[model samples]
Target: MGIKIGCCGFPVSRKKYYGEFNVVELQNTFYDLPSIDWAENLRSEAPGDFEFTIKAWQVITHPASSPTWKKMRRKPRGDTSNYGFLKPSNENLEALRETVRVAEALKSKIIVLQTPPSLPYSRESVEWVREFFSKASDIAQGFILGWEPRGEWSKARELYDIIEEFGIVHIVDPFRATPHLGKGGVVYFRLHGIGGSEVNYRYKYTDDDLKRLHEIVSKYSVDREVYVLFNNVYMFDDAARFKRLINS
Candidate 1:
Protein backbone atom coordinates (compact mmCIF):
# COMPACT_ATOMS: atom_id res chain seq x y z
CA MET A 1 0.00 0.00 0.00
CA GLY A 2 1.17 3.51 -0.86
CA ILE A 3 -0.10 7.07 -1.16
CA LYS A 4 -0.24 9.01 -4.43
CA ILE A 5 -0.40 12.78 -3.98
CA GLY A 6 -1.38 15.19 -6.70
CA CYS A 7 -3.46 18.25 -7.53
CA CYS A 8 -6.84 18.44 -9.28
CA GLY A 9 -5.17 20.15 -12.23
CA PHE A 10 -1.64 20.81 -13.38
CA PRO A 11 -0.53 23.76 -11.29
CA VAL A 12 2.85 23.78 -12.97
CA SER A 13 4.28 22.94 -16.37
CA ARG A 14 3.75 19.31 -17.44
CA LYS A 15 7.46 18.53 -17.29
CA LYS A 16 7.81 20.00 -13.80
CA TYR A 17 4.60 18.36 -12.58
CA TYR A 18 5.63 14.89 -13.79
CA GLY A 19 9.01 15.36 -12.16
CA GLU A 20 7.37 15.96 -8.78
CA PHE A 21 4.33 13.69 -8.83
CA ASN A 22 3.28 10.48 -10.55
CA VAL A 23 -0.46 11.16 -10.65
CA VAL A 24 -2.90 13.91 -11.66
CA GLU A 25 -6.70 14.12 -11.82
CA LEU A 26 -7.33 15.91 -15.14
CA GLN A 27 -9.90 18.69 -14.66
CA ASN A 28 -10.07 19.78 -18.29
CA THR A 29 -12.12 16.74 -19.28
CA PHE A 30 -14.83 17.78 -16.85
CA TYR A 31 -15.38 21.19 -18.45
CA ASP A 32 -14.84 20.13 -22.05
CA LEU A 33 -14.20 16.85 -23.75
CA PRO A 34 -10.98 17.03 -25.76
CA SER A 35 -10.22 15.34 -29.06
CA ILE A 36 -8.87 11.78 -28.87
CA ASP A 37 -5.76 12.88 -30.75
CA TRP A 38 -5.15 15.59 -28.14
CA ALA A 39 -5.66 13.14 -25.29
CA GLU A 40 -3.34 10.59 -26.94
CA ASN A 41 -0.65 13.23 -27.40
CA LEU A 42 -0.83 14.08 -23.71
CA ARG A 43 -0.63 10.39 -22.82
CA SER A 44 2.37 9.84 -25.06
CA GLU A 45 4.17 12.88 -23.61
CA ALA A 46 3.91 11.66 -20.04
CA PRO A 47 6.03 8.92 -18.50
CA GLY A 48 4.76 5.41 -19.00
CA ASP A 49 4.21 4.89 -15.28
CA PHE A 50 2.40 8.16 -14.74
CA GLU A 51 -1.24 7.78 -13.75
CA PHE A 52 -4.04 9.88 -15.23
CA THR A 53 -7.51 9.99 -13.74
CA ILE A 54 -10.05 12.10 -15.62
CA LYS A 55 -13.18 13.83 -14.41
CA ALA A 56 -16.14 12.78 -16.55
CA TRP A 57 -17.61 15.40 -18.90
CA GLN A 58 -20.14 17.81 -17.37
CA VAL A 59 -22.79 16.68 -19.83
CA ILE A 60 -22.87 13.35 -18.01
CA THR A 61 -24.08 14.95 -14.80
CA HIS A 62 -24.74 18.70 -15.01
CA PRO A 63 -27.69 20.44 -16.68
CA ALA A 64 -27.22 23.14 -19.33
CA SER A 65 -28.04 25.88 -16.81
CA SER A 66 -24.77 25.08 -15.03
CA PRO A 67 -22.29 27.89 -15.54
CA THR A 68 -19.72 25.31 -16.56
CA TRP A 69 -21.66 24.92 -19.81
CA LYS A 70 -20.42 28.37 -20.83
CA LYS A 71 -16.92 26.92 -21.02
CA MET A 72 -17.96 24.12 -23.35
CA ARG A 73 -17.53 24.50 -27.10
CA ARG A 74 -21.13 23.51 -27.89
CA LYS A 75 -23.79 24.88 -25.60
CA PRO A 76 -27.13 23.13 -25.35
CA ARG A 77 -30.08 24.71 -27.14
CA GLY A 78 -33.61 25.34 -25.80
CA ASP A 79 -35.12 23.21 -23.01
CA THR A 80 -31.61 22.34 -21.85
CA SER A 81 -32.85 20.98 -18.55
CA ASN A 82 -33.00 17.44 -19.93
CA TYR A 83 -29.53 17.57 -21.47
CA GLY A 84 -27.85 16.21 -18.39
CA PHE A 85 -28.69 15.18 -14.80
CA LEU A 86 -28.15 11.54 -15.91
CA LYS A 87 -31.62 11.42 -17.42
CA PRO A 88 -30.70 8.65 -19.95
CA SER A 89 -31.20 11.11 -22.78
CA ASN A 90 -29.44 10.48 -26.10
CA GLU A 91 -27.40 13.70 -25.85
CA ASN A 92 -26.13 12.86 -22.37
CA LEU A 93 -25.35 9.30 -23.47
CA GLU A 94 -23.40 10.57 -26.45
CA ALA A 95 -21.51 12.96 -24.20
CA LEU A 96 -20.60 10.11 -21.87
CA ARG A 97 -19.43 8.00 -24.83
CA GLU A 98 -17.14 10.83 -25.88
CA THR A 99 -15.83 11.13 -22.34
CA VAL A 100 -15.11 7.38 -22.27
CA ARG A 101 -13.31 7.65 -25.59
CA VAL A 102 -11.11 10.41 -24.25
CA ALA A 103 -10.35 8.42 -21.14
CA GLU A 104 -9.48 5.40 -23.23
CA ALA A 105 -7.15 7.48 -25.37
CA LEU A 106 -5.39 8.75 -22.29
CA LYS A 107 -5.20 5.25 -20.79
CA SER A 108 -6.94 6.64 -17.74
CA LYS A 109 -7.44 4.15 -14.90
CA ILE A 110 -10.27 6.05 -13.28
CA ILE A 111 -13.15 8.21 -14.54
CA VAL A 112 -14.78 10.37 -11.88
CA LEU A 113 -18.42 11.39 -12.23
CA GLN A 114 -19.17 14.32 -9.93
CA THR A 115 -22.85 15.20 -9.72
CA PRO A 116 -23.95 18.73 -8.92
CA PRO A 117 -25.46 19.70 -5.55
CA SER A 118 -28.85 20.16 -7.22
CA LEU A 119 -29.14 16.37 -7.70
CA PRO A 120 -30.35 15.75 -4.18
CA TYR A 121 -30.95 12.45 -2.34
CA SER A 122 -34.20 10.78 -3.36
CA ARG A 123 -35.58 7.51 -4.66
CA GLU A 124 -35.88 8.97 -8.13
CA SER A 125 -32.32 10.23 -8.07
CA VAL A 126 -31.07 6.81 -6.98
CA GLU A 127 -33.08 5.12 -9.73
CA TRP A 128 -31.69 7.56 -12.29
CA VAL A 129 -28.15 6.85 -11.15
CA ARG A 130 -28.75 3.13 -11.26
CA GLU A 131 -30.13 3.31 -14.75
CA PHE A 132 -27.36 5.58 -15.99
CA PHE A 133 -24.62 3.41 -14.53
CA SER A 134 -26.20 0.26 -15.88
CA LYS A 135 -25.78 1.62 -19.40
CA ALA A 136 -22.55 3.50 -18.67
CA SER A 137 -20.89 0.37 -17.28
CA ASP A 138 -20.83 -1.27 -20.70
CA ILE A 139 -19.10 1.66 -22.38
CA ALA A 140 -16.74 2.55 -19.51
CA GLN A 141 -15.24 -0.88 -19.18
CA GLY A 142 -11.57 -1.36 -18.14
CA PHE A 143 -11.68 1.69 -15.84
CA ILE A 144 -12.73 2.25 -12.26
CA LEU A 145 -15.86 4.37 -11.95
CA GLY A 146 -15.43 6.93 -9.22
CA TRP A 147 -18.42 9.00 -8.04
CA GLU A 148 -18.51 12.22 -6.06
CA PRO A 149 -22.12 12.83 -5.12
CA ARG A 150 -22.79 16.25 -3.63
CA GLY A 151 -25.55 17.57 -1.32
CA GLU A 152 -27.87 15.14 0.47
CA TRP A 153 -26.77 12.26 -1.74
CA SER A 154 -23.56 12.27 0.24
CA LYS A 155 -25.43 11.17 3.37
CA ALA A 156 -27.91 8.72 1.87
CA ARG A 157 -27.39 5.05 2.66
CA GLU A 158 -29.34 4.14 -0.46
CA LEU A 159 -26.70 5.96 -2.52
CA TYR A 160 -23.90 3.93 -0.96
CA ASP A 161 -25.81 0.72 -1.57
CA ILE A 162 -26.23 1.64 -5.20
CA ILE A 163 -22.54 2.55 -5.46
CA GLU A 164 -21.51 -0.78 -3.95
CA GLU A 165 -23.86 -2.66 -6.23
CA PHE A 166 -22.09 -1.17 -9.22
CA GLY A 167 -18.57 -1.35 -7.73
CA ILE A 168 -18.07 2.44 -7.83
CA VAL A 169 -15.36 4.05 -5.74
CA HIS A 170 -16.54 6.91 -3.55
CA ILE A 171 -14.67 10.16 -4.15
CA VAL A 172 -14.79 12.31 -1.04
CA ASP A 173 -13.32 15.26 0.81
CA PRO A 174 -12.11 13.62 4.03
CA PHE A 175 -12.65 16.85 5.96
CA ARG A 176 -16.29 16.91 4.96
CA ALA A 177 -17.34 13.27 5.28
CA THR A 178 -16.06 9.71 5.41
CA PRO A 179 -16.85 7.75 2.27
CA HIS A 180 -19.77 5.36 2.64
CA LEU A 181 -19.09 3.38 -0.56
CA GLY A 182 -16.08 1.36 0.58
CA LYS A 183 -16.09 -1.40 -2.04
CA GLY A 184 -12.84 -0.76 -3.89
CA GLY A 185 -9.15 -1.11 -3.08
CA VAL A 186 -8.60 2.58 -3.84
CA VAL A 187 -9.34 5.38 -1.39
CA TYR A 188 -9.70 8.65 -3.25
CA PHE A 189 -9.59 11.83 -1.18
CA ARG A 190 -10.17 15.25 -2.71
CA LEU A 191 -9.06 18.04 -0.39
CA HIS A 192 -10.91 21.27 -1.06
CA GLY A 193 -9.81 23.08 2.15
CA ILE A 194 -11.68 23.15 5.49
CA GLY A 195 -13.46 25.43 7.99
CA GLY A 196 -16.26 26.55 5.70
CA SER A 197 -19.88 25.61 5.05
CA GLU A 198 -18.87 24.66 1.52
CA VAL A 199 -15.54 24.05 -0.14
CA ASN A 200 -13.06 26.79 0.87
CA TYR A 201 -10.79 27.04 -2.17
CA ARG A 202 -9.00 30.08 -0.67
CA TYR A 203 -7.67 28.16 2.29
CA LYS A 204 -4.06 26.98 2.51
CA TYR A 205 -3.05 23.97 4.52
CA THR A 206 -0.61 24.14 7.41
CA ASP A 207 1.99 21.60 8.51
CA ASP A 208 -0.39 20.33 11.16
CA ASP A 209 -3.03 19.82 8.52
CA LEU A 210 -0.56 17.94 6.36
CA LYS A 211 0.39 15.77 9.35
CA ARG A 212 -3.24 14.97 10.00
CA LEU A 213 -3.66 14.05 6.34
CA HIS A 214 -0.59 11.85 6.57
CA GLU A 215 -2.11 10.00 9.48
CA ILE A 216 -5.25 9.32 7.53
CA VAL A 217 -3.28 8.13 4.52
CA SER A 218 -1.11 5.90 6.66
CA LYS A 219 -4.15 4.27 8.18
CA TYR A 220 -5.77 3.59 4.84
CA SER A 221 -2.69 2.99 2.68
CA VAL A 222 -1.71 -0.13 4.59
CA ASP A 223 -3.68 -2.21 2.09
CA ARG A 224 -5.30 0.15 -0.41
CA GLU A 225 -3.84 2.83 -2.65
CA VAL A 226 -4.77 6.21 -1.20
CA TYR A 227 -5.03 9.10 -3.64
CA VAL A 228 -4.86 12.53 -1.97
CA LEU A 229 -5.68 15.25 -4.48
CA PHE A 230 -5.53 18.90 -3.43
CA ASN A 231 -8.15 21.18 -4.94
CA ASN A 232 -7.40 24.41 -3.12
CA VAL A 233 -5.53 27.70 -3.66
CA TYR A 234 -2.09 26.26 -2.81
CA MET A 235 -2.69 22.80 -4.23
CA PHE A 236 0.72 22.30 -5.76
CA ASP A 237 2.62 23.31 -2.64
CA ASP A 238 0.22 21.54 -0.31
CA ALA A 239 0.35 18.31 -2.29
CA ALA A 240 4.14 18.45 -2.41
CA ARG A 241 4.35 19.09 1.32
CA PHE A 242 1.97 16.18 1.95
CA LYS A 243 4.03 13.91 -0.27
CA ARG A 244 7.16 14.78 1.67
CA LEU A 245 5.39 14.30 5.02
CA ILE A 246 4.10 10.87 4.04
CA ASN A 247 7.49 9.85 2.68
CA SER A 248 9.22 11.01 5.85
Candidate 2:
Protein backbone atom coordinates (compact mmCIF):
# COMPACT_ATOMS: atom_id res chain seq x y z
CA MET A 1 0.00 0.00 0.00
CA GLY A 2 1.16 3.50 -0.83
CA ILE A 3 0.23 5.46 2.30
CA LYS A 4 0.88 9.22 2.35
CA ILE A 5 0.83 10.40 5.94
CA GLY A 6 0.37 14.02 7.11
CA CYS A 7 -1.70 16.38 9.26
CA CYS A 8 -5.06 17.83 8.19
CA GLY A 9 -3.38 21.26 8.14
CA PHE A 10 0.03 22.71 8.79
CA PRO A 11 0.07 21.81 12.47
CA VAL A 12 3.44 23.48 12.57
CA SER A 13 4.88 26.35 10.57
CA ARG A 14 4.63 25.79 6.81
CA LYS A 15 8.41 25.61 6.55
CA LYS A 16 8.61 23.05 9.33
CA TYR A 17 5.66 21.11 7.94
CA TYR A 18 7.19 20.95 4.49
CA GLY A 19 10.48 19.87 5.96
CA GLU A 20 8.92 17.01 7.90
CA PHE A 21 6.04 15.81 5.71
CA ASN A 22 5.25 15.80 2.00
CA VAL A 23 1.46 16.09 2.17
CA VAL A 24 -1.10 18.38 3.86
CA GLU A 25 -4.86 18.78 3.75
CA LEU A 26 -5.72 22.51 3.48
CA GLN A 27 -8.42 23.42 6.01
CA ASN A 28 -7.79 27.09 5.36
CA THR A 29 -9.38 26.76 1.93
CA PHE A 30 -12.59 25.57 3.59
CA TYR A 31 -12.76 28.63 5.82
CA ASP A 32 -11.41 31.12 3.26
CA LEU A 33 -9.18 30.99 0.23
CA PRO A 34 -5.68 32.33 0.44
CA SER A 35 -4.74 34.83 -2.24
CA ILE A 36 -3.69 33.24 -5.51
CA ASP A 37 -0.29 34.88 -5.27
CA TRP A 38 0.19 33.46 -1.78
CA ALA A 39 -0.81 29.97 -2.90
CA GLU A 40 1.50 30.23 -5.89
CA ASN A 41 4.32 31.44 -3.65
CA LEU A 42 3.85 28.50 -1.30
CA ARG A 43 3.88 26.12 -4.23
CA SER A 44 7.22 27.56 -5.27
CA GLU A 45 8.53 27.43 -1.70
CA ALA A 46 7.85 23.71 -1.18
CA PRO A 47 9.67 20.71 -2.56
CA GLY A 48 8.39 19.55 -5.92
CA ASP A 49 7.19 16.25 -4.41
CA PHE A 50 5.09 17.99 -1.77
CA GLU A 51 1.30 17.72 -2.24
CA PHE A 52 -1.63 19.87 -1.17
CA THR A 53 -5.13 18.45 -0.88
CA ILE A 54 -7.92 20.96 -0.29
CA LYS A 55 -11.05 20.99 1.81
CA ALA A 56 -13.58 22.51 -0.57
CA TRP A 57 -14.88 26.00 0.23
CA GLN A 58 -17.61 26.03 2.87
CA VAL A 59 -20.06 27.82 0.62
CA ILE A 60 -20.02 24.63 -1.40
CA THR A 61 -20.92 22.43 1.58
CA HIS A 62 -22.07 24.54 4.55
CA PRO A 63 -25.09 26.70 5.33
CA ALA A 64 -24.76 30.33 6.47
CA SER A 65 -25.73 29.28 9.99
CA SER A 66 -22.64 27.07 10.19
CA PRO A 67 -20.13 28.18 12.81
CA THR A 68 -17.34 27.50 10.30
CA TRP A 69 -18.01 30.93 8.77
CA LYS A 70 -16.91 32.64 12.01
CA LYS A 71 -13.28 31.94 11.01
CA MET A 72 -13.70 33.24 7.45
CA ARG A 73 -11.10 35.78 6.37
CA ARG A 74 -14.02 37.32 4.45
CA LYS A 75 -17.76 36.78 4.29
CA PRO A 76 -20.24 36.08 1.51
CA ARG A 77 -21.50 39.19 -0.32
CA GLY A 78 -24.81 37.87 -1.73
CA ASP A 79 -27.80 35.75 -0.81
CA THR A 80 -26.65 32.75 1.30
CA SER A 81 -29.64 30.51 0.60
CA ASN A 82 -28.26 28.79 -2.50
CA TYR A 83 -25.04 28.00 -0.65
CA GLY A 84 -24.27 24.81 1.32
CA PHE A 85 -25.44 21.18 1.53
CA LEU A 86 -24.64 20.49 -2.13
CA LYS A 87 -27.53 22.50 -3.58
CA PRO A 88 -26.02 22.42 -7.13
CA SER A 89 -27.19 26.00 -7.71
CA ASN A 90 -25.41 28.89 -9.41
CA GLU A 91 -23.96 30.37 -6.23
CA ASN A 92 -22.69 27.04 -4.99
CA LEU A 93 -21.23 26.19 -8.38
CA GLU A 94 -19.49 29.56 -8.37
CA ALA A 95 -18.15 28.79 -4.93
CA LEU A 96 -16.71 25.52 -6.27
CA ARG A 97 -15.18 27.40 -9.18
CA GLU A 98 -13.43 29.74 -6.77
CA THR A 99 -12.21 26.72 -4.81
CA VAL A 100 -10.79 25.14 -7.98
CA ARG A 101 -8.97 28.34 -8.84
CA VAL A 102 -7.25 28.24 -5.47
CA ALA A 103 -6.59 24.53 -5.83
CA GLU A 104 -5.09 25.09 -9.24
CA ALA A 105 -2.80 27.74 -7.79
CA LEU A 106 -1.69 25.38 -5.03
CA LYS A 107 -1.08 22.53 -7.49
CA SER A 108 -3.65 20.55 -5.57
CA LYS A 109 -4.70 17.13 -6.90
CA ILE A 110 -7.63 16.48 -4.54
CA ILE A 111 -10.56 18.71 -3.60
CA VAL A 112 -12.64 17.27 -0.77
CA LEU A 113 -16.32 18.03 -0.23
CA GLN A 114 -17.34 17.25 3.34
CA THR A 115 -21.15 17.40 3.54
CA PRO A 116 -23.39 17.92 6.54
CA PRO A 117 -25.61 15.23 8.06
CA SER A 118 -28.68 17.30 7.27
CA LEU A 119 -28.34 16.12 3.69
CA PRO A 120 -28.83 12.49 4.63
CA TYR A 121 -28.97 9.53 2.27
CA SER A 122 -32.04 9.80 0.06
CA ARG A 123 -33.03 9.73 -3.59
CA GLU A 124 -33.34 13.51 -3.57
CA SER A 125 -30.00 14.10 -1.80
CA VAL A 126 -28.21 11.59 -4.03
CA GLU A 127 -29.61 13.22 -7.18
CA TRP A 128 -28.64 16.65 -5.89
CA VAL A 129 -25.09 15.53 -5.08
CA ARG A 130 -24.82 13.66 -8.38
CA GLU A 131 -25.59 16.92 -10.19
CA PHE A 132 -23.26 18.83 -7.93
CA PHE A 133 -20.48 16.34 -8.67
CA SER A 134 -21.35 16.53 -12.34
CA LYS A 135 -20.85 20.29 -12.46
CA ALA A 136 -17.91 20.24 -10.06
CA SER A 137 -16.13 17.65 -12.19
CA ASP A 138 -16.56 19.81 -15.25
CA ILE A 139 -15.00 22.80 -13.47
CA ALA A 140 -12.12 20.83 -11.95
CA GLN A 141 -10.25 19.27 -14.82
CA GLY A 142 -7.39 16.81 -14.13
CA PHE A 143 -8.21 16.85 -10.40
CA ILE A 144 -9.58 14.09 -8.19
CA LEU A 145 -12.78 14.85 -6.24
CA GLY A 146 -13.25 13.38 -2.76
CA TRP A 147 -16.62 13.31 -0.98
CA GLU A 148 -16.90 12.73 2.80
CA PRO A 149 -20.59 12.16 3.38
CA ARG A 150 -21.66 12.38 7.02
CA GLY A 151 -24.40 10.77 9.23
CA GLU A 152 -26.55 8.09 7.71
CA TRP A 153 -24.87 8.45 4.36
CA SER A 154 -21.78 6.80 5.75
CA LYS A 155 -23.44 3.38 5.82
CA ALA A 156 -26.18 4.07 3.31
CA ARG A 157 -26.57 1.91 0.20
CA GLU A 158 -27.01 4.95 -2.04
CA LEU A 159 -23.43 6.00 -1.20
CA TYR A 160 -21.88 3.35 -3.48
CA ASP A 161 -23.90 4.27 -6.55
CA ILE A 162 -23.03 7.97 -6.63
CA ILE A 163 -19.36 7.31 -5.94
CA GLU A 164 -19.19 4.85 -8.82
CA GLU A 165 -21.18 7.11 -11.14
CA PHE A 166 -18.97 10.14 -10.47
CA GLY A 167 -15.64 8.37 -9.98
CA ILE A 168 -15.42 10.06 -6.56
CA VAL A 169 -13.05 8.89 -3.85
CA HIS A 170 -15.07 7.96 -0.79
CA ILE A 171 -13.30 9.79 2.05
CA VAL A 172 -13.78 8.41 5.56
CA ASP A 173 -12.21 7.59 8.91
CA PRO A 174 -11.26 3.93 8.64
CA PHE A 175 -12.15 3.57 12.33
CA ARG A 176 -15.68 4.84 11.75
CA ALA A 177 -16.59 2.92 8.65
CA THR A 178 -14.93 0.99 5.82
CA PRO A 179 -14.67 3.31 2.88
CA HIS A 180 -16.71 2.16 -0.08
CA LEU A 181 -14.55 1.45 -3.11
CA GLY A 182 -14.88 3.94 -5.97
CA LYS A 183 -13.37 4.67 -9.35
CA GLY A 184 -11.32 7.59 -7.97
CA GLY A 185 -8.28 5.33 -7.29
CA VAL A 186 -7.50 6.66 -3.81
CA VAL A 187 -8.31 5.58 -0.25
CA TYR A 188 -8.49 8.74 1.85
CA PHE A 189 -8.72 8.58 5.66
CA ARG A 190 -9.22 11.61 7.93
CA LEU A 191 -8.60 10.59 11.54
CA HIS A 192 -10.77 12.33 14.14
CA GLY A 193 -9.98 9.85 16.96
CA ILE A 194 -11.90 6.94 18.50
CA GLY A 195 -15.13 8.80 19.13
CA GLY A 196 -17.24 5.95 17.82
CA SER A 197 -19.52 7.65 15.28
CA GLU A 198 -18.75 11.31 16.07
CA VAL A 199 -15.54 13.31 15.84
CA ASN A 200 -13.51 13.66 19.04
CA TYR A 201 -10.96 16.32 18.17
CA ARG A 202 -9.63 16.44 21.72
CA TYR A 203 -8.76 12.75 21.89
CA LYS A 204 -5.12 11.71 21.65
CA TYR A 205 -4.48 8.47 19.80
CA THR A 206 -2.57 5.79 21.72
CA ASP A 207 0.16 3.47 20.48
CA ASP A 208 -2.24 0.53 20.43
CA ASP A 209 -4.68 2.63 18.44
CA LEU A 210 -1.99 3.30 15.89
CA LYS A 211 -1.24 -0.41 15.70
CA ARG A 212 -4.87 -1.20 15.08
CA LEU A 213 -4.99 1.55 12.47
CA HIS A 214 -2.12 -0.07 10.60
CA GLU A 215 -3.86 -3.41 10.85
CA ILE A 216 -7.16 -1.90 9.72
CA VAL A 217 -5.45 -0.32 6.75
CA SER A 218 -3.87 -3.59 5.67
CA LYS A 219 -7.32 -5.12 5.15
CA TYR A 220 -7.82 -3.09 1.99
CA SER A 221 -6.82 -5.17 -1.03
CA VAL A 222 -7.01 -2.28 -3.46
CA ASP A 223 -3.98 -0.91 -5.29
CA ARG A 224 -4.95 2.74 -4.83
CA GLU A 225 -2.80 5.33 -3.09
CA VAL A 226 -3.84 5.82 0.55
CA TYR A 227 -3.90 9.23 2.26
CA VAL A 228 -3.86 9.11 6.08
CA LEU A 229 -4.32 12.55 7.56
CA PHE A 230 -4.54 13.22 11.30
CA ASN A 231 -7.03 15.94 12.34
CA ASN A 232 -7.00 15.79 16.14
CA VAL A 233 -5.45 18.02 18.82
CA TYR A 234 -2.25 15.98 18.70
CA MET A 235 -2.26 15.63 14.94
CA PHE A 236 1.31 16.72 14.43
CA ASP A 237 2.76 14.11 16.77
CA ASP A 238 0.27 11.42 15.85
CA ALA A 239 0.80 11.85 12.16
CA ALA A 240 4.56 11.65 12.58
CA ARG A 241 4.14 8.47 14.59
CA PHE A 242 1.84 6.91 12.05
CA LYS A 243 4.24 7.82 9.24
CA ARG A 244 7.07 6.12 11.06
CA LEU A 245 4.98 3.01 11.70
CA ILE A 246 3.95 2.69 8.08
CA ASN A 247 7.50 3.15 6.87
CA SER A 248 8.84 0.61 9.37
* Best model per lDDT: 2
Model 1 earns a TM-score of 0.95
- Candidate 1: worst 10 consecutive residues by lDDT? 74-83
Query: How many residue pairs collide in each prediction?
Result: 0, 0
Top TM-score prediction, candidate number: 1
Q: What residue pairs clash in candidate 2, if any at all?
A: none
| Residue-wise C-alpha lDDT for candidate 1, range 1-248, written one tens digit per residue | 88889999999999999999999999999887888999999999999999999999898788877889899996644456667777766677777788889998998889988888887567887788788888877777878889988887777778777777888898899888887646779989999999886589999999998888787778888889889999999999999988888777
Report how far off residue 43 is in candidate 1 (Å).
0.7
Compose the digit string of candidate 2's lDDT tens values, residues 1-248: 47788999888898889888999999988988778898899899989999999999898898888888788877766688878988889989888888888999999999999988766567887788789888877988799999898887777877788888878899988888788887666889999988755698988999999999998776662577889899999999999898888779
Backbone clashes in model 2: 0
Alpha carbon lDDT at 108, candidate 1: 88
Q: State the weakest 10-residue window (summed lDDT) of model 2.
A: 216-225
Q: What's the lDDT for all of these models?
A: 0.85, 0.86
What is the TM-score of each predicted model, taking all chains together?
0.95, 0.94
